[model samples]
Target: MDLENQLKNLFPDHVSEKVSEKKDSEEKGIWLQDDPIICKYEKRKGKPITILEGYTGATEDFKKLAKELKQKLSVGGSFKDDKIIIQGDYRDKIMQILKDKGFAVKRVGG
Candidate 1:
């Protein structure tokens, strides 16, 4: 017997729910929130690094944002501890990018 037939026989009166399909991809969609995403800078080992925090989205979404930022800036970076760490200090540029994507960005520190 086919798997579907066996399942029907076992459940007897089970009704499978219909699944919905989304034609759009969420990755192509940028999520906007009320609170601004915190953009800050600090020197690590005498080198400047930009850090972005306070993003209350799925980790996958944050990682996608980080990848887009790195590609746009052509810089190396990583997502660690639920924060994004990008090489060098590109606070102004990064903030602009986020703003264009409909995310409120707040500059914090030098």
Candidate 2:
């Protein structure tokens, strides 16, 4: 039997139409908050740090993205609380990377 017919027979009650509709909504766009990106230098226990905030993204994808960014910038970084923290000041660099990745990004505080 054809794949479509076989699937229909397997789930007689549930159909593919409902699944398609839900998939359409999810493909619209990556939902991003209207908040400015914030970058700042911080000191933690006498160690210098750089923090980036105002980001909303899925944890797994966020980590993957962070990994790529760190590699690109040739710096060390980590993801925590839905935020990306890269060593040193890399606001412009990170902004450019996100833009290149087709993300609607805006730089906020210095």
Could you report the Cα RMSD, in angstroms, for every candidate shown?
A: 7.9, 7.3
Runs with alpha carbons beyond 4 Å of true place in candidate 1: 1-28
- What overall lDDT, based on C-alpha atoms, would model 2 receive against the true structure? 0.69
Residue 76's lDDT within candidate 1 is: 99
Q: Report the C-alpha lDDT of model 2 over 4-83, residue by residue, as the tens digit.
A: 89988888887566356743454344444555556666667776566766666556666776777799889998988878
TM-score per candidate, in order? 0.74, 0.56
Model 2 CA lDDT for position 93:
78
Each model's lDDT comes to 0.89, 0.69
Q: Cα lDDT for residue 80, model 1?
A: 100
Clash pairs, candidate 2, are none
